[model samples]
Structure formats: C-alpha cells, structure tokens
Target: MKEFDIIVCGATGYTGQLACEHLARSYGSELRWAMAGRDMAKLRSIQARFEVPSHVQLIEVDITDAAAAASLAERARTILSTAGPFANVGEPLVAACAHNGTDYVDVSGDAVWIRKMLDRYQEVAAGSGARLIFTCGFDSVPSDLGVFFLQELARERFGAPAKTVKGRIRRLVGGLSGGTLASGRASIQAAGADPKIPQLLANPFALVPGFDGPAQPVGNAPVFDPDVKSWVAPFILAGMNAKSVHLSNALLGWSYGKDFTYDEMIMLPGAEDADSAREAADANIWSNVVRALQIDLKPGEGPSEAELAAGSFEMIFVGRTASGQEISTTVTGEGDPYALTPRIVAECAVCLTQDGTTATGGVWTAAAALGEPLRRRLEQRAGMSFSVA
Candidate 1:
C-alpha cells in the first residue's frame, strides 16, 4: 500500500501551492504525496486546483496540535514544510519528526531557531534516524552547495580541498515573500528581547557547536575584489549561509579543512562609478529602514505569475586552494526565488524518500545531507544550471 511518500505541511500557503503545482506537474502518478494544513477546506481547494493524482491525500492538522502533527509525521517517510517565521510553528513538527524517525526538510533561513533545534533535537533525530535538513531554499542552498561544488572540484583538480571559498551574488531579480519579511521581523524581535541573540546571529560559527575556527572575513562592509573585478557588498543571507556551510564542514568531519574560511557578498555591477559604490555600501542600512516601516508583503501575498516567471538569479562561487590556485563556477536559475523554492523543497523531500541517503539522522544542511544527489536533481529536475565559469 502506498501511504504518502511525502507530506507538504503548509500546502495552502503561496509557496506551498507552488510546491503542489510542481509535484503535480512533475510526479503526478509516480509519487504518493499529500497536502497538509490546519484547514481541510483550504487543502482540498488547493488539491483540486493542482490537478494532482487522485491518490494525493489531503490532511488536516494544526501545527499547534501535537497529536495531529505527530500522527501526520508517522504516516509519511518525509515531511517537506514551507511554513515559516518558524520560531512559532516549527518546533512541534520538528519534535514530532524527531520522535517518529521521519525525515524532514524546510526552507527556513532562521539561524537562531535553527541553532536551538540543533541543540535540542540533533541528538534525538540522530538516535531516531530522522534527518532534519533546513535552508533548502534560495537563502542558503546556492551559497552552501556552491561552496560544496567548488570544494569537490578543488579536490578533483588540485588533489586538495579549497581553504577559502567566496559566494557572490551576480544577479537576482525577485521580490521577497511575506513569510520572509515576517521571519525577519520575528528575528529582530527575538534579538531585541535577549541581548545575546544578536551575538549568536553575528557569530560566524554559530551553527558549528563546540568548534570555532579561525576568524572569518567580515562581509558586512563593501569592498572591491581584484579577482572578480567588481565591488561587493554584504549579502543579507551571508551570516546564515556561512553557518550552514560550516555545519556541513563539521558534519563531513572537517573535510573542507578545519581552517576553512567562507564569506558571501553581492556583486555591484556599476561599482566603477563612485556614486554606485557609495550606494552599495549603504544598501543594508536603507533596507533596514524599509523593513522597519513594515511596508512589505504579508502572508498569502506574493508576485503575480508573470512577475515570478520573469525573475531569475545568478550566483558565482570562487574557490582558492592553500597554494592559491583558484577555480570558479556559477549557479543560475530561472523564475522567482519564491516560485523556485517550492520545487527545491519538494524535490529535496522526494530525494530523501526515493534515494534513501546514506546520511544518518540529525540536523543537516543541503550540501551535507543531499550533496551531489541534490545538485543533480536541481539541474536535471528543476530549471537550474551549474557550470564552471
């Protein structure tokens, strides 16, 4: 009997609907999956709109209801969640999945919450065989996996790992999702309530508990890169992505090197212009002002299909070996980050269910848990391209 191969826990949300649409289009009859949320009517409505296979189930369960979440977790081999501002609604499902030995994936980029999950559930999930992976979406996947891809090449070409890798966002044309904004607000509130939370957020090694490597480059300031020939500014997701990369390095027994150094920034195209350089330097401050005004999208709101279709992103990773041999690669994708995230999250869950990774349970990053298998899935199954540049 085919129970659900995967369960999408927030199927009615904007991103959730995109995931369902992708699953319906890609796997229809081949995969047994379900749409789950607190509202049966909403789930059923989304189910009808997607034209998924008749076998696709609709599950009604509130994140707040521990029993319902646990029961749902027990029925599926993997649970892929798009629910976020995860600090509020994520723990119960993590607890349920850890206890049930069911694999789980989420697109959350909340490092603070993720750190707590690692401390509380990593051992339990490891003991129970539940592989909980986070930041499966655009926020950290490209950054994490870009470094992974570079290190793999370094070992192949130079017969050694790259000691330093840089992730630079070349281009990104997309709007932020309301869920992302909400999460940002929640994180700020958390940091304000507890003074130490900001320190955790600022720590380059926050995710790699008990091990701190050498001092990392401060990517928060704008600087010119001689190699890339462009001015770079702090990438907003750098801190979170750095933590994920370091965690992956730790999980892989420090194969990337105990002294691995990573940083991320956004490339400023017109940086030769003095005005543009100044603007790039102040981008983070201006962004914060905008966010403080709370003038962004709300939950269940997002770009139109045309806008989503037109959006795209390109990321470049530059790897430098101990001997200073450098190699570069670019990861590019079509569609908005929000639109693409669902596919990424869904495919990750499918990879876990069908491929049955050799990785033992516990908290995992995309590169550490899925690695080349995920890279293949993204390139082959999703509309993404990765190439040496």
Candidate 2:
C-alpha cells in the first residue's frame, strides 16, 4: 500500500498549483494525496493559498535527484506531473515511475520529448506495470478522446472501423501558457541542434517506432472541405494529438483499422467569405509571431477566474468507413483549456488509481489507457461532454 493515492510532482509550478487546487476542491478529505516539489516554501505558499487539507502532506523531492524521485514514486500509486519544459524536467520522474511501477500522467504537449520518452521507457513501463501517460490535458485529450468516441459510434453504425478520421476544432476560446511556449521553444532548439530530431518531429509515425501506416495527409496547410462546409486551418496541437491517436490505435491492436488516417485542423466559419479567417488559418505562422511577441502568460500566471469561466471549446470529429459510411461526434468542454487542464489531469490520476484497465502497463495515450472510464469521469466530474452529432 502506497502512502498516497496520488502525488503531484512539480506542485509549485502554475499547472501543478492548479492541479492541487482542483484535487483539494474535488476530493477534499477523501483522497490521500500529497504535493511534492523541490522548493518547500513555494509548496507551502500553494498550500496556504488553496487552504489545502491538513492531511495532504507536502514532500520535497527534486526531479533531478534519482533517489528522491524513486522514493517519491514508491510513495504513490499514481503521480501527476506539471513541470516543464519536459525535455529538461520530465525524464527522471518518468524513469522513476517506470522502475517502481507507479502510474504517471502529465500535460506535456512536447511531441519530440514524448517520442524519446516512449522509446526509452515503453518496454520498461510494460514490464513493471507502470502506465506512463502523456498529453492528459487540453493539448491532446479532447482530440484523442473525440476520435475514440467517434470511432466507437462508427463501429456501431457502420459495422467496421473508420479508415479515416478528421478532427476539426469548431470553436476554441483560450490562451496559451508561458510553460507551453517554453516547451515549444525547447523543441525548436532541440530540432535546430539535431537534424534527426526534426525528421522525427515531422513523421506521424514517430511515436509508433518502426510501424509506419499508409500515407497521411499533410494537415499543416489550410484547406476548404465540402463535407464540413468550412475552411480549415492547421491546428497548432495537431502534431501531438495525431501521434497520440495513432499510437492509441496501435495499442488497441488497430481496432480503428490498420490504414486508419487522422488529421486535425481548426474550422473557420464563413468559408471563402472571411479574409481574416483565411489569414488566421496558418497556425504555424501565427504561432511563430506569438513566440516572437513573447506575450503569453508566464508560469504561475493565467487568466482571471472570470475569464476562465467564460472560456470554452467545441471540437467536431468526422469518421469515414471504407464503405463510405460516415459518423460524427462533438466534444464540448467548459472553462479555459489551461484552467480546466488541472481538473482533467487530476481525474486521470484518480482514474488510474481506482479504475484503470488491466492492460494498463505501458506508454499510453489517455484514451487508450483510461478509455471509457476516463471518458465517463470527464463527463461527470470535469467540465466536458461527448455526444453524437
């Protein structure tokens, strides 16, 4: 029996603090969880601010210290991490969890870093019964699970898996965090330093490792789709989400079809009528401009409570079977993506501890590892809803 049901490492970071606040608010005295970080004073500050329960212990565990990380993993059945850039701070904790067989979750959207972690720890995690899950937050969760939900519907209706799925962001109201930008910068820097890193980043099958599926559509450009009757722009997080969805398919024995195809883009209303919409369709271009502006909220800085409450997103997934049968579903969520990420991640930790699948020990996507249990939990506990359109 571990001492804690969950341990939130990097508890002093902005997202970590949010996770703690959500855990405290949602679980209260019910969960036996603790906050762990290198800076005890910052951890204490979070505790004071959130009025964390007295039973919620605070542990000082440096992520870089292998021994301390191992001890921290040993003390918890599951660990939710928010520290980043993950390339710098994520590996040690992942290694510790894999070795100790402790389930782990993180909100990292760094695809390059995630690929490295999977390559290094997948077998170790599988052997040790540790479930290492990444992109549990807004970056991939909505897209990943939305595809899962749509595919399930497709199977039920079409009597076969959808060979192709398109994830389109219908509406999104939110802002990016400084931590997210930092992770992006880190990946960019790494790619600049190593040419092979860029190649891996470009490949949709990078996470699958040696398993390249059929030709995938290049979703990095804007296109007009007659099916959805909208102009679609490249989605910034599509790279990360695509890999996770593909890996989930692979992990589930290609239930979605061996030739399954996936691509994500942001849907802009008023197709061909709005010039500004066409300009906004280039996500990479705007992302670069935003990075140059450096106006994103810093770590521990985010939208006001009112702003977060006002923010929301709705994503539409369209799945097409080989026989041309199509099914669609919508995943809608309330609140700002960053603000609600903590709750999503917290519920993932809880689900991992209490109701995860038996085949859970591996590097997994949130949809593949937690599956319907998490999907239902998000609908019930988190501010998310999934339904057929």
Candidate 3:
C-alpha cells in the first residue's frame, strides 16, 4: 500500500493543530507525515500557517465517508485521529483503518463507544493485521503508562508483579481545547437522552476488552483509604483508563500480573495536612459549584506558546507488590494537560508506524501497543520525564 509515514486526521481543529505543530517540530526532517480533514480549505490554511513541508500531503476527507476513509487508510501507514466525541462520529474511520491494515490511534475516552467498536471491528482488524489503539492522550495515557511503568518497576525490584496498582493525580493544572469541551458537552447531552449511557459510566468494565458483564452500581465514591494513606475521589476517567490497563494485561499476558486490581483518584493537594485538606475540601466545593454553573475555571481555547514552553504536570503511580514491596514512579510533562493530549495522540500514530507492532486488529487501547514505548518517549522527547522513587 502506498503511504506516508503518518497521517494526522482532523489536523485543522484546535488540538489537531497543536499536534501537527509538535510533530513537525520534533520529526519534520525525518518523518514523512501529513495533515488531513473534511475541509481541504481548512487543512490548507493550517498547512500555510505552519509552513508544512512539501513531503507532507494534505488528505482531505470526511470521517463519515467510508470510501474516502478507506482511501485515507490505504495512504497512511499510521493514522492519528483527533476527531471525536468518538461515540458519535468515529466508527467509519476505524473501520477503514482495520480493513486497510493501517495502525490507528486517537484520544477517545468514551467507554461505551470503545465497547461497541471492539464488538464490531475487532475480528476484521485481527484478520487485516491492524492495530487500533485508543485513549492515547490526557484522558488515559498518564494512567495507562503509569501502570506499565509501575509493573516494570515491580518486576525489577521484587521479581514479580504488583497485585494492586493505584494512580492518584497529585496535581493537575491545564486548560481544555474547544474540541474537548464540545465532545464533553455532546457526551453529556447524549447521556441525558439515553439514561443507560450515564448509568454505564460508573461501571469500570464499560470500555474493557472481553468484558461483556452486565452493569452494576459503582462500588463507592473514594474516601481516605488509610491503607494507601490518600484521600480519593471517583476518578472522572476511570471507566476508560482502568479498562485500557486491564486490556493491556489481557493482551500482553505476563507484562501486567494476573489478579491485578487498579483504581484511580484525584488526590487533592494537602490531603494529608488537616488544614490544607480542609482548604482543599472548600476549594472542591467551590469548584463543583462553578462546574454546575458551567464556568470553566481553566479557561482557554488552548495553551499559549509560553504555556507550552513553561507548563508542566506531574502524576505519581503507586504500586504494592505481592511480596509487600512498595514502588512508585513519577511522570511529568510540559504544556497544558488537555492541549498536550492531541500531540500525544498524534505521536502515538507515528510511534506505532515506526515500531511495527503487529496485532490482529481489533479494538485496542494505548496501553496495548504504545504504552511502554510512549512512556519512554514521553521521558525522552516530549518534555516529559518518568522516574522511579
């Protein structure tokens, strides 16, 4: 099949633009990549603004057009799709990629959509040798890769895997792109229309591979678990990220231990200090009120150049091995967390193409193919670093 090394679909959108910029800055000379979208004019505009090289093609096609999508799949070894809310408008592109044996990646955190995709496309993908990796961005990448890193640490330190892994966001500060906000609004609206969508969200297995179990109530809102010595909240993206890590466990088999239980939480700053914890609680109350009013505290279309240069976030993954060894690793990165996601998604496509990971294309998640490699790259090139403690 004729192909560019990477094809970034939805490259004209906000997150898509940042992704293209990051890719160009990092791999422009070495990688043959291009910009793509439904609007050729918009794609051309982005190309002109960025001064994209001649080698990078502009493939304009609608994600909804199956035939055109198939043509795109045939033209690119790897495809990074920033088009979403995936539950609404992502399947056709996925189908083309599976059929054409092209590796696919996206920044989707939709559990129900993932489940549907796995059911509909997994077999075709397997036959075609396509790898469809999803949620390779802010929503789940940090957690997925954190799990992988922790498990690797467990093996190296204790000669066995951790029976339980916990990922707590120690601190997060960033703005969301308009695209992400729109996706979330759409998800909320759709959920309001379909009650099941809202209910299924609480189920951890909602997006997990090989999990067809009926839904049940979420166990409990997280509280201070003295065992882990951290206060926790119901993880906003747990349904997506937790399942991804589990799927990786299933696919990679021994990389992540059997009987592994994973959970995520937002660790409010000063959770351990009584005064700071009280202040945090008050802040959370205010934050919820603002969200209720739809006032986005982290306001921005995306990060500024200065923020991209100076912005950073950190997350620590805590692991407890079966042998009682405690391990932790920290992952840090630059740029607005949400804005940085699209770049992560775009880079995933490039990495998958270069790495030549073979998979029977079925629905997949970041943890399955690009998890470890991404962690490495995040450390090396993305102004992100990971280290064991």
TM-score of candidate 2 relative to the true fold = 0.95
* CA-lDDT, candidates in order: 0.85, 0.85, 0.72
Total backbone clashes of model 1? 0
lDDT by residue for model 2 (1-389), tens: 88999999889988899899999988898899999988899999999999999899999878888888899999999989998888898899999999999999999988888888998999899899999999999978998888888888887887898899998888888776778777777788888899998788778888898897898889665678766889887777888889889988998889998888999888876657456665665343322334433665566666677778888989888888998988888999999898779989999999988885866578988898888999999998889999998
Clashing pairs in 2: none
User: Which prediction has the highest TM-score against the true structure?
Assistant: 1
Tell me the TM-score of model 3. Answer: 0.88
Per-residue alpha-carbon lDDT of model 1 for 2-86, expressed as tens digits?
2778999888888988999999999888888888887898887888887877788888878767898898888988999988768
TM-score of every model versus the real structure: 0.96, 0.95, 0.88
Q: After superposition, how far is residue 252 of candidate 3 from its true place, in Å?
A: 1.7
lDDT of 1: 0.85
Q: Write the per-residue lDDT of candidate 3 for residues 170-237, one digit (tens) a residue.
A: 66666445565666676777778988887666566665544553332242353675644777555456
